[model samples]
Target chain A: MDILRLIIAGSVDNGKSTLMGRLLYDSKSVMQDQLEAMEKHSRSQAAGCPDLALLTDGLRAEREQGITIDVAYKYFSTTRRKFILADAPGHVQYTRNMVTGCSNSDLAVIMVDARHGLVEQTNRHTLIASMLGVPHLVVAINKMDLVDYAQERFEQITSEFSKLTQGYTFQTLTFIPMCALQGDNVVQPSTHMPWYQGPTLLRFLEQVEVRRHTNLSEARFPVQYVIRQQTSPDYRGYAGKIISGSYRKGDVVRVLPVGMESVISAVEVGGQKVEEACAPRSVVLRLADSVEVKRGDVIVKPDSLPTTTQELEVMLCWLDNKPLLSGNNYLLQLNSSVVQARVGQVAYRVNVTTLRQEPAPEHVAQNDVVKTTLHTDSPLPHDAYTCLRENGGAILIDKTNLATVGACMIQ
Target chain B: MGTHTLDYLEELESEAIHILREVAGQCERPALLFSGGKDSIVLVHLALKAFRPGTFPFPLLHIDTGHNFQETLDFRDQLVERIGERLIVRHVEDTIQAKALTEPSGRFASRNTLQIHTLLDAIQEFSLDACIGGARRDEEKARAKERVFSVRDAAGQWNPNLQRPELWSTYNGRVQKGQHVRVFPISNWTELDVWEYIQREGIEVPALYFAHEREVVEQQGQLMATSGLFPQGAAAAIRRRVRYRTIGDMTCTAAVPSEAATVAAVIQELLATRVSERGATRLDDQLSEAAMEDRKLKGYF
Candidate 1:
């Protein structure tokens, strides 16, 4: 079965956790003993149902404050597919946490309260999800019970959401109206809403086609390590995962940055000889000649070569408390490669609400999304983030504190 | 499909292998924390797949609580010998003796907390910048909030609020002089996923995971093995056919009644069970509501 990684995003009181709990509970994935524990620890229970939100609030501070601060992953499997849900915090100050959750997700579940139509937080989350290239989106207009299960409210909310995502490139956009607390239209269809004619949220998640964005035509393998056998002095193997594309024995390949060409001598996965290996599989390959290949070097097909340059234009999401200024140096870590780099120019900051580029600021603070240029001390092999995310994404690490300060998507 | 697709197990394995390579590529000195349990055993198997044909860059470290089962110890030694990799064993007993620590005395006393002292000491002794553990987020609540590369201070304290944001697959492994990062490659795997992978790969674990006749001390709907260190004064020990869901200090880990002699049978039983792995088998976690979070703050794994 395929595994689906989804993130639930909303404002603080939009019931993201309740939706997750309802999903697990209704699917019967919540064990009996765990349910009993949750009930025993629950301090408040309204409407005679257990406080399902307590199940995801695992930390002490979160339990005390009754809010989610970071991302917490929960796992459950149905007959059709397995799901890995990332419950991200909804507060505006925790946008980095939301970005972290959206980075690897295949789908985004944007939660909205029907009582209040699309708000600024909803727009921000939708924009971040679009920026991160989440293929599918399911906008859940929650709390239908509070809105008297009105069909007009649901339609109004859906219309506003459609207007907000006018120019976004989401592959699939679905809108569902439900009450997560009353178990209506989440796992089971609501008995109160006879006007609605759509699949329940669970049904949509189970049937949605989430394609793996692995590019097989243009192979890109960044060498992570070099293995040289001690007993067999003649054996040298380059070990790494194929970030994109495939490799076969006897195929001629090029090693990047070093500019050496060699024929593929052998291919091995998990220590056994294989005829070929594809993207995302960790394998070791032997070159016909010893061409001085080392870690941080990209091995790819000669015809579809990646950009080899020292300057790059990138869209960066600043994640640190310290402000990011121009001409500041940090370590840029790409897939299996790290190089010293400096922030050259802040071109523009994105106005998330309007999806427009504003004037550049002197310093960018935490959770600021900016388009900028980066200069590396050494040549880097990369692709556009829109083309191949695996080869294009990079993170900036602080030089003194060693914290990841920025996430850069190569433009 | 134009692009080649992998099965769910294969995908999880690939993700884990990628994380292992990151540890090898980033950290200068790292160690794989090995136990005789199935999770760490699977870690060893993945390590072989990751760095085989070449020797492992780091050694395997085990913080023995001195309250372990003999079968697990023997299995550890044999596996290390078979792989021909360096094994570093640090004893919590030695730490207790050297530091004049008092052992918890009760019906079910455990050295679970004391093992942290030895683990922290081993890190400083070897100057290990990274320690790859077999912790899965699906196991417990606090771990579910943990990052794949969890950073700890020089004193080995974990401040959940200060956790650095981990985005995508890129991990920041840089740390200060006495600090180290705890990397969990199998963070995404659940208990069922681990068992399914074990069945798929045909990896061997300790014999205790299967059903066997042993004398166990029954208490509070839990069954713990009768060991020398266990104070079994009033509670009667009886022979029962049981199996362990997890492997830990004998004083703390419990067994469940089962007839799962094979991996497939165990996976089948897991699917039909109601209680979670830790909820059904661990004795130490029943101490309080925030037991794991508290232990993590005090440098306990």
Candidate 2:
């Protein structure tokens, strides 16, 4: 079975955690001991129900506050597929945490309450997921039981969400009416909603074709570490992960920034020599001639080379509590390369709630998404994020604290 | 990497290898926190794939609790010798004597907490900037929320609320002069994934993983091997065919009754079990709801 990395987004009390808990519990992922503990904890509360939401609320502060503060990862598997669920916070203040979770997910499971319909949180999450380039969207109109299992309510919510997402692009959009609290249409089909006919959430997740999204035509390999053999002094193997596309043994490759040309004499993946290495595989490449290649260098096929530039336009998400200013100088890291970069210009700030671009502000505060220009000290070989996400993504590190301050998607 | 389409195992392996290399490329003085358990064993194997044909940029560091099984120590030594890598061992007993620390006295008094002190001291002594651990996110609740490159304070304390936002494959391994980072390379792998990888790669583990007849005692619904550390030779002690699900201090790590002797059988057995790896084996986690979180905040691995 393949892997599916998914993120579940919803507003508070929208039953996001309940939906995740139902999926894991019905799939036999929750153990008997955990069930017992949940039961014991449940009895202490007033509701006295099996509080499945407590499972995802791992931290003590979250449990006490009864909300998710950070993105907590949960894992489960079935015979059909393995799942890695990024349970993101629903609060508007934690938008950066949601972006962090949505950055690597293959699909986004967005929750919309049937009663409230598409609220500000729903549109914000959808916009952020779309901005982060999440391929698929699953709009789960949860808590349908409270709506008397009305098909019209589900349709109304779906249409509203569809209209809200009119400007965005998703490869696949699926609508499911689920009562996560009642275990309806989550792991098993719902009996109350007889009018609704659709695959359960688990079934849809298992059958989603997400692996084809990997870019195979544009080969980009960012050199991470250069390995020199002590036994053989002349062996200089470029160790790095093939972020996108593939490289063959005899393929002529070019070292980026330096523009040095060489032929791939050998490709070693997983410690074994292979004729060709594909994307997402950590491999070591042996060049015919020893060129000036080290960490923070890219090796790509000469035919499909990325744009090498010192000036880059990117969509930046401010994560740190400190606002990002125009003159801020942060350490910009793209793949293996790190360069001292300065924020050049803030073009416009995209309002996450309405999905609209407004005038640039003086400073981009926490969780604000803005289009900006960055000037790096050294030239970087990168692709547009829309064309190839692996090579286009970057992060801005705080110079003072060494903390990751912002996330950048090259445009 | 061999086939055009990688299975889940291969994908997980590739991701882990990438993380391993990131630690090597980012940090100047890195070390692999090796315990003789199956998870760390798989970590060592992945490190070999990551930096073979060239020496690893890091050495293996083991924080011994002194309440270990002889079999595990022997296996650790043999593996280090065969791999021809540097192995540094710091004993909790030595730390206790030097610091005049008091040991917890109980039926199964674990040195698990005391080992944290030894680990921090060793890190300071070696000035190691990066410590690559074998912790999996699927192991515990707090661990599920941990980042791949978890940064710690100068005192080696983890601040869960102040974690950095880890985005994409790009990791920020930068640290100040006094701070250090704890990197988990196999954070995505589950317990079953480790066993499956062990079976697939033919990675050697201690014989305690397989079923063997040994003197055992049942305590709090867990089957623990009878050892000198916990001298419970009363009516509760009985000989049973058992195997350890996780290897830690012998005083706290429990065993389960199983007949699986080979790696394939162990995988099959794991597939049939409903209890979690740590829940069924480790006793320290049973103390509180946030046991792991509290321990992590105090610098316990």
Candidate 3:
């Protein structure tokens, strides 16, 4: 089954976990024993109702504070689809966790309360989702039941959200009024939501054209492992997963910055010869003849090869307690390749909620997103992160603390 | 899944194979952490599949808890024999006897936590830089934060806040000496994916995961199987129609009431069941929210 990697985001207590729990419960994904346990715990805590929010909110700190502290992953499946739901904490203090959850999501469901209309956190999440290049966005206006299940109330909230998020670029943008507490327009279509003609949240997820998100422009394979026979003579081959595009046997490809073109002699995996490989699948690619290919060596179509640059201008999301100092060398990771990159130019810092750029500061603080320049020791072969989402981005780690201080989307 | 899509099942396999290769090429002296469980069984398959015809680049290492299901031990040995690969086992009981660790206090106490001491000691002993695990992200909340090439300090502690940004297919496997990496090749895979792949590839798994009759004690919601050494009171009783959710020390790992004798039925039940694989059986995780986090920090890959 094709597992849909979905990120659930909304302001605190906007029913993010409740909605997820409802989905799991109604779908029969939660088992009899687990449900019994949840119910038992529920009866011990509250009155009659089992708080579905208890499902993803696993931490005791969260239970005490009644808020999600970290990103909790919940798995549930329908015969039609498997869902990898990453439920992230929405507190501003934990925005870093939220960013991590939305990083690789296929779709982001930003919930809005019908009563509250639009909040700052909702905008921040929507902005982050769009900025991360997540193709689909669903504005789930939850708690329609609170507003007497009014269709007009749903439209008002939807219209208000649209005015602000209109500039956001997304392949699929939808609005579904739901009540996670009451199971309306969540799993089954709500009779109350007859005015809403669109498919329910689950159906929309199943029908969303994921094919449009796949990039088939050209093949880009980053070598993760180099295989060699341990028992025999130096039997060497470069092994890695294909990030994007495809490669087949006998296809001529370039060995990146070395620019040595060679034909793929074999795609040997498990002693069997495979015809080709595509994005995200790891495979061993054999060259017709031996070449000096090792770890971090990228393989791509010679014609569509990304430019190798020493100076990188990227949008950085600073995530650390200490400020980023100029000229400090950090571990720069792009794909499977890791190289030492020095802080070159500290461009103006961009506000998280607003895209407005301010004058460059001497020190970049925690949770600050800045557009900066990176000068690497070696030429980094990659495209603008926007074009090749995979190759174009890099995460900078503080070599000292070993914390991922910043993530960059190469412009 | 799509014309452009790699088969959903095959996609996970390819991703795993890619990661295994990455470890071999990047780390100086890496080892595959084989537990002989279906997850690790799948790992062995992926590693073998990763480097076909040619022998695997790295050695296989097992942290023998001493307390284990005999079926698992048999399968582990059988797998090593079949693949003709070297395996280095460092015993938890031996580690405890060596004064490196201490035995826990109660009937619920398991050597699962003590596996870390042996694992870390083994790493230092072998001078292995990267330890490959079959830990899937979907297994736990803390694991959900894992990077494919997770770097650990000299103490083998994981700092999630400092995880390397894994973008697209690029995995940065570079790490400092003494600061080895913990690579989870199957980080994205779910329990169902493992079963489907096992069925498709016809990979051999320990028979314990399948339905079987066994002696057990239901304590704190986990069906504890009688390992004979624990010396349980009359509370422990034998039961039938049981399958192991996860293969670990027979004492800590629970057996769910399952009739899913075949892999397909297991997959079907897993799809329908709401209790997660670990939630159903993992005794160690029930200890605390930071349980896995603490062990991971200690470099228990």
Candidate 4:
């Protein structure tokens, strides 16, 4: 069966949860007890009827405070496909949550309040989705019932969102006008908005192409473990998850930095012998002969291998409260390797709203997207994160506190 | 890739095997949390494929709730015996008896939350720095924000806001002296993938997973099984057809009416089904807005 992973985003009180709950409810994905609980919780709040958004706003503080704290996952299936919706919070403070929600997401289903059109939070979420490089987008103009489900109003919001999303790398942008509270354009075909002939949210979600690659080539295997047995003292193996490419017994592979070459004598993991292993696969390799490989060294094919370097240019989205300090050292982790790194230079910063690049800042604030250079203690095998993120991305940690403060993609 | 090779699922299996190897290699003392559930069973099979031809570098651990289904216990024992690996089983009731836990009462009572105590105790007992669980992100809303290598505080609590973002395959398993990491290799796999993988690999699962006739009753609009401990309410016993959406404490777990009698049929049912597995069956989550999160903070698995 086909499976799709999409991220749902909207401003505070824009019915993000309501839209999600509507989709789930209309799709018949909600169980009887859950529906009853939601109804009970909703009426107790004295808001007339229970909010369908309560289904996903599960954080007690979020429930009590009436705001989404972080991203919540919702699972449902249509007759044709299985859908995993990553519902992200809209508050600017929780932009990091939205980033985390959208990281591996295949599509972005952004919602706009029919009454308010596009607001600051809408721009923030849409920008965050674009910055995370989400491939597909659907701007659901919600609350159409309040606006009379008019085609003119729907077109107004769609153009506004489209005007802001002009220069980006999205595959397709769909606009569906509907009132989530009234069940229009969510699951069923909206009778009120006949001018809008596009598929409903469920139909659009079912049809969205969600092809993602794991980069199963070039064969980067960093040694996370070194194996030795008392029975076979001479036998040694390097174990790690494959970042890219395929590896098999008899294939000649190179161990990084030390530059030792060897043939794969055997490929064994969890006691089963396999002929080969590829990207995203975790396995152990036995060399044709003994090799001195440790936890930090990487093994890869001699050809199509990555460039090893001490310095890198990165597109970074700072995710911490303390901001960026150039003098401070942070531990950089990419794949199975970890090294000491420093922010060498903040080349420039970009304005998410205007899509304009400005001169380098002295330091970055929270939610600032910047281009910077980093220097590492050791050479890192690198690829452009946009091209092959599994091998090309890294997280910067506050060395003293061990807090992951920033995420960087190799440029 | 072999001819007639499985496409994405096989690739996913290979990826999981690689993660298993990394866990074994990177951590000094690593253990797999075997529940005898389909996910854990699949994990064991993947583990066997990960460290073949020698004794695995790690041991297998099961945090027994003592309220476990007898079939699951039997399957657990049989699998452990067949694998010939060291199996460490810790009991929650043992902790209750030790005064380490104050048991809950009423229909709301569950050792499900108590498994955390036994689990953390076992982790300390074995000095295991890495404990692998079969938790998938799709199971609930709170689990979605989880890191593949989730770090727990000394108190064994997960802070949703304090997670290290795992953008790529880069996983950080580092923690302080008393703190440990809970690694989930199958964090990305959905319910469908798990079922499809099980069916594809012909992996052995508990008999309860398939179609089985059992006395049940409708409680709170859910079909509660009538077992030794959990009383079947006065609802009629018309056994139309059914299967379990989730397997948990028999006292609270619910089942659904399904004609799916085989693995392939079950997969088809899952594909055609609109509601989530937990959505259809979980009674415990119906209690609070952040039920899963609260339980997780209290060290629920």
Candidate 5:
């Protein structure tokens, strides 16, 4: 079976956790012992029915506050396919957590309450999802039962969501009316809505194709480790997972940043020799000639090499409580390479909800996205985020505290 | 099929190898926690593939509870010898005598909890910057929230609230002095996936995992193997074919009634089993709702 990674994003009280619980419950993924434990805890709290949110709220503090604070991952599989769900918190302050969840996801499910149509939180999440390049979006209009399952309410929300998607880039967009509390159009078709003809949420998820999203036309391999034999001095290999494209045994490749050309003498995966290997496969390649190569070095096809430079223009999202000040030095880590870097200029801050640009901000606060430029101490090989995600995305860590403070996408 | 695609097992193997290589490249001083269990055995296999034709950058560290089954100890020694790697074993008995850690006394008394002190002491003694473990998120609730690279404070305590946001495949391996990170390579794998991989890779495990006719005694509705440290009483021991799903201290690990003598049969049984691997075999986890969480907070692997 194949695995589909997805993120659930929404505002507070939009029933994100409830929808997850219903999916697991309806699919029979919840085991007997886990259900019993939830039941026992519910009775102690005098809750008549088991709180579905308790299923995803694994932390004690989350249960106490009745809200999710961190990204909680859940796994379940049906006969058709398997799923890895990242449940992101909904509060405005936790936007960084949502970004963390969406970074690796192939799809995003945005929930909105039907009674209060479109809100700022919805706009913010949708924009972030687009910025992260999430290919698929499912705008689930939740709590339809509260609105008497009215067709007008669902259409109004969908039309409003359409207005927001006018400037965003999404490969696929879907809208579904759901009542997570009552299990309406979540796992099974809702009898109450005869006018709406669409697949249930579970059905859409099961049938969605998780195609390879990595760049396959240009071969890129970042050397993670060097394997050398002590007794036999002739044995040497460069081991890493291929980020994009394919490599064959006799292909000529160039070592990046140093620009040394070498021929691939052999390719091996799991200790067996293979003629060819492709993206996402961890393998070791033996070069015909001895060349100086180590970790943080990229090996790519000579014709499709990435740009190597010390100056970078990027769109960065501030992730730490400490404000990012211009001219402050930080560590820029991309792929396996780490180097000293400083923020050069703050171009503008983009208002995620209103889509307005504020020029010349003094400092970027937490959860704020800005367009900026950076100067690195050393030159590094990178691609535009619009071209290749693996080579374009990077994170900035504080030199003093070693905390990941910002996420940058090379523009 | 015209397009080349990897199966589920192959994909899982690739991911694990990537994680192991990341630890070797990033961490200054790293060690693999080997317990002679099936999961740890798989981890070792992946480490070998990650850097073959050369010795591992990190050594194997084992915390011996001294209540181990003889089969497990023998298996650990032979595997280390075959791989030609260094092994460091620290005994809980030594820590118990030095630190005056009280041992539980009763029919259900186990030295499992006491192993934490020895593990922490080993981490301090070796100055290991990263400890690679085989813990899976599907095992318990608290484990489900753990990051691929989980950080620990100077005092070896885990604060769930202060966990770093792990995005994409980028792991923040930066740590201060006297601090370390615990890396779980198989955090995304399920129990069934482990068994299937073990079978595919042809990895060797302790004999206790296979069904055998052994003398056993039923206590608190769990079957205890009479072969190891358990004291045999006057009551005649019952002989039944059983297999172990998890291997820990001999006193804490329980056996289930089964006829799975081979790896294929074990996979078949796993498909039909409803209870989780830890739920059926571990007595320590059944103590409370937050049993694993509490142990992890105090630096338990």
Candidate 6:
């Protein structure tokens, strides 16, 4: 079965966790003991029904504060597919956590409270999902029970979200009306709203086509480790996951940034020889010639080499509490490559609420997305994030504290 | 057909290999935490696929609780010998004798908690910058919140509140002096996934994982294996065909009555089992709701 990595984003009280819990509960994925524990905890708190939100709020602080603090991942599987759900907090301060969830997700389930319709947090999350190039989106119009499960209210919210979708570029957008608390269109179809005809959220997730969003036409392999036989002096192999495209025996490839070319001698997966290797599979490739490949070096098809440059223009999401200052040095880590980089200039900061570009912000503050230029100490092989996410996406770490400061996408 | 769709097991294997490679590339000195359990066995296999032709860049470290099943120890030795890799074993008894740690004594007394001291000591003794473990997030609640590259302080303590943001697959493996990182390559995998991968790969696991006739005693609603370490008089012993879902200390690792002698049968049994692996087998986790989280904060792996 295919594994779908999805993220659930919504403001506080929109029932993102409840929606997830409903999926697991109705699908019979939640174990009996865990359900018993949740029920007991809910009764102790005098909740009318088993508090589904308590299932995803695992942390003690989150339970006490009744808010999600960081990204919490939950897993479940159906007969057709498996899911890795990332529950991200909706508070504006925790946007970085949402980004962390979106980084590996193929789809974003942005929940909107039917009463509030389209809110600021909804727009911000949609924008971030668009920026991260999440292929699919499911706008869950949650808490329909509170809005009396009215078809007109769902339609109003759906049309408002449709207007907002114009600002984002999601390959597929879907709208589902559900009450996560009462188990409406979330898992079982809502009998309360017979006017609406659509698949349940669970059915949609199982049927959604989670395409492998990699550039299979352009081969890009970043050598992570070199394996050399201790006994056999002639054995040499380069180990890495193919980020894009494929490699076959005798296929001519080039070691990037160093500008050396070689032929693929052999490909091995799980210690056995394979005729071909494709994107996202970890394999060890033996080059025909010893071309001096290192851990951070990228190998690609020689005919379609990426641009090698010392200067990079990137759109960065500042994650650290420390504001970004121009001319301050940080470490830019892309794939396995780490280089000393300094911010050259801040071109513009995105006002996520208004979707406006504020020109030349004084300092990039926490949770601010800014377009900036950076100068690295050494030249590196890279492509724009739009061209190749595996090779283009990066993270900036503080030189002193070593905390992840920013998420970068090469422009 | 020239399609590139990977099965669930294949996808999990690819993700694990990627994580292993990242740890090898980033850390200065790393070691694999092997326990001869099925999970760590899979980890060793992935490591071999990750860097073989060559020996692994790091050694294998095992914190011997001194209360282990002889079968597990023998399996560890044989596997290490077959792979031709270095193995380092540290004993919890050493710390107990040194007066650095006091073993818990009770009806349910086991040296499981004391393994943390031995593990931390081993890390410091070997000066390891990173230690790769085979922990899966689906195993526990706290584990579900753990980052793949979990950073620990000088005291080897885990602060769930203050973890660094891990965006995409880019892990911040930087650590200061006396600090180290714990990398879990199989964090995304589930128990069924592990069993399926083991079956698909035809990997050899310990004999204890399969059903066998063994002398066991009923304690606290769990079937504890009665052996040389535990006399039959400790509890009422009976012969039963059983297998272990997880392998830790013999005192803490319980057995489930099953006739699943083969991997395929074991998979079939697991598909019908309701309780989690730890919930059914581990005796220590029954103490409280936050048992795993509390143990993790105190530096237990």
Chain A TM-scores of each predicted structure, in the order given, are 0.94, 0.95, 0.93, 0.86, 0.94, 0.95
Q: Pick out the ten consecutive residues of candidate 1 chain A with the lowest summed lDDT.
A: A61-70
- The TM-score measured for candidate 3 stands at 0.91
lDDT of 6 by residue, B211-289 (tens): 9999899987899998555444557789999999999998888999999999999999988987788988988877778
Q: A388, model 2: CA deviation in Å?
A: 0.9
Model 5: per-residue lDDT, tens digit, B188-238?
888888998889889888889999888888877788887546555554679
TM-score preference between candidates 2 and 6, better one: 2
What DockQ was computed for model 4?
A: 0.35
- Runs in model 5 deviating more than 4 A are A43-49, A61-69, A231-233, B1-3, B227-237
Badly placed stretches (over 4 Å) of model 3 are A36-44, A58-70, A93-95, A230-235, B100-102, B141-153, B157-177, B214-225, B235-241, B269-276, B279-301
After TM-score superposition, the amount by which residue A70's alpha carbon in candidate 2 deviates from its true location, in angstroms, is 2.6
Q: TM-score of the candidate numbered 1?
A: 0.97
Query: lDDT per model, in order?
Result: 0.88, 0.88, 0.77, 0.76, 0.85, 0.85
Judge candidate 3 against the unseen true structure and give its global Cα lDDT, from 0 to 1: 0.77
| lDDT, residue A163, candidate 2 | 87
DockQ scores of the candidates: 0.67, 0.67, 0.45, 0.35, 0.56, 0.62
- Candidate 1 chain B has its poorest 10 consecutive residues by lDDT at B1-10
What are the models' TM-scores?
0.97, 0.97, 0.91, 0.84, 0.95, 0.96
lDDT by residue for model 5 (A16-84), tens: 888998887788777767877777666445456567777775676456655344677787777777778
Inter-residue clash pairs, candidate 6: none
Interface RMSD of each: 1.8, 2.0, 3.7, 3.9, 2.0, 1.8
Candidate 3 chain B has its poorest 10 consecutive residues by lDDT at B161-170
RMSD of 3: 3.2
Q: Which runs of model 4 end up more than 4 angstroms from their true locations? A: A43-50, A61-69, A113-118, A143-167, A173-201, A208-211, A214-254, A257-303, A357-363, B1-15, B18-22, B53-55, B100-110, B190-192, B211-261, B265-291
Q: lDDT for model 1, on a 0 to 1 scale?
A: 0.88
